[model samples]
Target: MKEKFALGTALLVASTVPVFGQQYRAGSSDTMDQNNQQDTQRGSCCTSCCDECCPPKDPCAKCAQLWPSCGPDWIITPGAGPCTADGCDFFVTAEFLYWAVRQDHLGFAVTLPEPETTSVGEISHPDWRMELGFKVGIGWLTCIDGWDLYLNYTWLRPRTKNETASSKEGFFLQDYFLFGFFGPPGDFTLDNETAKWKLDFNVLDLEWGRNFYISKCLHLRPHFGLKGTWQEQKYDITANATQPRGSTQFFDTITGSADLKNDYWGIGPRAGLDTAWHFSRCFSVVGEFAITALWGRFDSRAKATQTLFDGSVTPAEETTTTIGTGSFKTEFHSVKPVMEFFLGFRWEDWWCCDEYYTGFDIGWEVQWWGGQNQFAFLPTETRWGDLGFHGLTVRARFQF
Candidate 1:
């Protein structure tokens, strides 16, 4: 009887052990599914983009900010004065410009005839002084699929004055040399020369663009626009010759004056890219590049006059195929290409319930206008020289 009882108890215990093990395993599976569901819910909370940006292996706590497309940087937004996070509607910008002009063709005087000295044949370049200018702009952050509109005006008027004295045996550079040929000066030896150059720059730009993120830390703004420009340049020089290279006799004084002007008005298409890499919530490094193709009219004229001590005058003026093909003066209708570049660092922030915005930045900018230096057309064959400007720009912006 005892042996039968022991066998029955062992069978019952074995059956109960297997049943308990099945139940525990089923509970463990259900618990694991619940935990997985919770983790998935937590990780899917990031709303910055459409695709699932969170990694499966990462902790749920970091899922919100660990977007795969974005690095540790924030997107730069161009919203109004107080509202920028979601989308901006309007903003205004103003910039202070301290710039200098670089023109390649304005050579007024040359020193003595030494092959070793750098100044022997080199044309004297005037001091490129920095002048103040201003730019004002208004933009609309449409928030319509992140599109924006901008209109702005820029103005600058800068001038440079220079004076040069030549050695007793050196002649002043003939005011305007002929294309492919630099001929002799009117006088044998030049004593002194004075020159003044002035420029008037006016521009209006209208752009349509959209800003978006390419990566977590980088953003790009691609833009297309119309650029209109009306600019004028004037260069005038006066030279005096008082000595002869051969004879020591008191030479008859010869004076020369040249008036040169180049003016243009054009309207064209402009395209550009603006980029920013944000390292912090409110600070970024930025760059911009642009190109313009202009279809417009250019008017260039130069007149040279020589006065002798004997009350005689000699005047120099001529027409070229490029200048007077269809017109009465030295003017033409053509296309000009211009390029611009900028790089800088900026700080921007928003407060007051994300309803206002303010920003500040400083940058270096350059603009190249191909074949824009038309100051010498007549008295010399139609030759072209490139013109450019480079300098510092400080900008302040606000949104409302």
Candidate 2:
């Protein structure tokens, strides 16, 4: 009780005391640096903690408190970083994400051209969007050459939706593995079509980095990390066809459905650079670029079913045009590379006499996975598709 009383007394006096010629940060009003000159012998490891509570370089440390987690001696080795006699050894962060994926592979068919129409094979595309997800992380400051270690996880499951398109004549499916399993090229047609898509994305990252100044106005953090991803994609399409057979005076009615799923997980080394151009203590512009080479396995499946309900207009004569049901599953291991980029603006500040830290960042991020859309229907047939993501990200961080 007595110690608390004295500590409160010291703080009240310290805040009001006027100290002259305080050294300012070289570039900005705030550099996350303590209010003192850096030690001459830089990067020297602190062998002990202060017993007397004298500040690392201030008279404030003199009104010291008992160190709960400190070394045998009182003196701490000096460095300019987050971890100071006052505070800043570790941090926690959270982020808000609103993102969407590209719709390249979502389209399955093209509108067939009729006798007098300019329909040059219009592609059917589905719109996919995401509402919200979360990214959370923790970090530890080693205070060794300003190095830090951190880990984070992200999870997002996009909403599923169906998009439909129709034609009076018919729709044509691409001959490649997209629909090659059921019919011959350019012969199969549909009266109406609908497409649906769903995706589950998971990512984990562990990194080691150090933030330091490259120039008066520029700061950078270069990090090397391992990233792991477990991603799954499901796509479905259904089509119906009703055409009159002039040769037989009957109607050829066909209905079919196709489903494809690509599930994979990979882990590999990732490296990146985080750059910050500080316009002032409270605001900065930031950008990042990272690449990872992932070694992973892909378990893919493709199945299709088609049925014929052929009948005459008069119901006097009838013939059924039936199509078969086919399915195939395969799993393989391969290596692929992913590249991601981001740019944003940041606002940060400290309160409570700089004992704690808080920051906010808003930005845009993009990611591309090479050959992520691996779809196959037969042992010999394979289709490679690239997956990409673009989104808005907002981050909030607190440190002590």
Candidate 3:
């Protein structure tokens, strides 16, 4: 009985030792797993904080490295980009404009169909007025450092009208008059007469130039160009007569019409300087001044006609008659000078894109030319005149 009891106790002790050993091994594994999880969480938090606080180096530095000549103090240039080998350095500009033309003198004629005519008397300079005009221009640029080639063209047309009232007693003939049936010069007079005048003026210009940048904010351009100007002047005078006058008998009234025309073409060289003051990255004030020297051709002509009215008939019977018609043409050379100035605001990188720009400008311009000849009624007598124009200009431009 004692041997069986001792064997049973040894078997129980052995079983209990194995169970305790298994619990110790399991606890060691769980502690090791917890330490690893804590370490992983700490590492993740440190990485995120560093990323948020730190900034990377500039990417432009890499560009500088590739192009060492750009230097350390490099700034991105406006208006044009750096030169590249693939030919991306061309640009174009288009503009629409309105100009308010000031009154100008083209030419004046004293008489129509020279040599003194019985149908018409002496005339003086007619009053001229100008209306609003429109213009369009296009420009192209080919860039190479500070040097570039440029071309531009502009056109404008303005309307004018005038009227004058004079009594037949106030009418006079020119001193050089030769042939007239109304006795002597200044002796002929029409009764109750009025005169009307109309004029049209047009101008066109085309130029090509090379640009030289004096600085980042200034430039000088020298150009050679062509200009064309055309003008037409018309006059009409009407008179009421109750009786006959000097060999010619008019039953009722008479109307006289006169037309004068001129054309001028010029070729010349011009030079200008342009400057800008920038108040912001996208806004600027600009000013420009230019002078030109031109060799020009001027052409002039004149014509006249008359119509008789008979109030004795119903609806006032009318008889059309060309009392006298004559044309005089001459070619002469002259010089013209021009000046212009402007101030405006500009918006760059239009539509949030770097390739486009738009701007507005208000300015003034003046142009003058000499050696214009005016045709008179007497072919022997011609008057020399000068041309001048001064005006305010407003323009909107777009560039790409």
Candidate 4:
């Protein structure tokens, strides 16, 4: 009986040892799994903290995301002034110009007397050349909203000269009877003579314009203006005469000079449309078209003088002067049309200030006038003319 009881006790101990070993293995696996879970949670927290401290990769995207309230209409400038806000309140501009003048009626016609009828001989006039000009303007924002007042002045001058010569063996009769005062009306042989022609033109303009803005980039301006123009022309002739010793003529040499002038003044109303299209922050295209109607007066004057030399007279040289004076004037109404177009590149925030800006433009322009009333024709007749220009323009602006 004692042997059987000891064997039973040994069996029970062996069974208990196996059960304890299984429990220990299970507890070790649970501890390892808990440690791995804690490590993963701590790593996730560190990653989130790093993300918050570092800057974003794209700045534009970040700014847009942060300032979603500011729309495209918002203007942000780096300087301070009224210009930094929305639009230019006050401004000034200076323009350099080059233009060509086209006035065909500003020429003179000369005719020689014929046996039966007078025939046209020669035509004389000064050729119009390209001329330089300038303009200056100032503007102010008025009390009326989107309305501005501006004043501008422009000036230009062009000049030309021509020389011609002719000779004849018989009586030289001028179809215009006024030229007969320079010499005797009889037949004579003439040699070596020269004629000179000179002309000068001047133009001035002053205008006051009121602008109504349709938007930030478009506007219509109607204007009232004053215009003045002056033209001066001179013609001179010199000749040497060979006459017989006993000839009955009074003079051996002749010289004549004639001067002509035309002055014009007008007051008018003008209207224009101005437009700008911006394709970038600093570049744009601009265009303008205008028309004006003017009521004006033209005043003309002509004068002539002649000197005659008679070698056969007392002192071997004689000088005589003759004067011809006349006035031809007219009063008329006219219309003028002008067009301008340009492609411009602008630099904003110039001189490190938003109130300062600079721009450059290259383009073409044309102007036409009707009923110009030239001095070359009869007082009752009128003429038309046109002018054109094309070149580069530079502009600097101060906004306040």
Q: Pick the candidate with the highest lDDT.
A: 2
Candidates in order have lDDT scores of: 0.68, 0.69, 0.46, 0.47
Global fold similarity of model 1 (TM-score): 0.70
lDDT tens string, model 2, 199-314? 79899999998766544345677899999999898888777766667767666777777888889999999999988776654567989999999999999998888777766666
Off by over 4 Å in 2: 1-85, 116-119, 169-179, 184-189, 245-252, 310-323, 377-379
lDDT of 4: 0.47
Measured over all alpha carbons after superposition, the RMSD of each candidate to the real structure, in angstroms, is 11.8, 12.5, 19.1, 18.9
Q: Candidate 3 — worst ten consecutive residues by lDDT sum? A: 62-71
Ranked by TM-score, the better of candidates 1 and 4 is 1
- Which prediction has the highest TM-score against the true structure? 2
Candidate 4 lDDT, tens digit per residue, 130-214? 7777777776654443345566666666555443334444324232212443435244434344444444544455555544333
lDDT assessment of candidate 2: 0.69
| TM of each candidate vs. truth | 0.70, 0.72, 0.57, 0.56
lDDT of 3 by residue, 80-151 (tens): 221222233345444444444432333222333333345665454444555455566656544433244445
Worst 10 residues of 1 by lDDT: 318-327
Preferred candidate (lDDT higher): 2 or 4 = 2
The positional error of residue 76 in candidate 1, measured at the CA in angstroms, is 16
Clashing pairs in 3: 111-377, 113-377, 114-377, 114-378, 115-378, 168-190
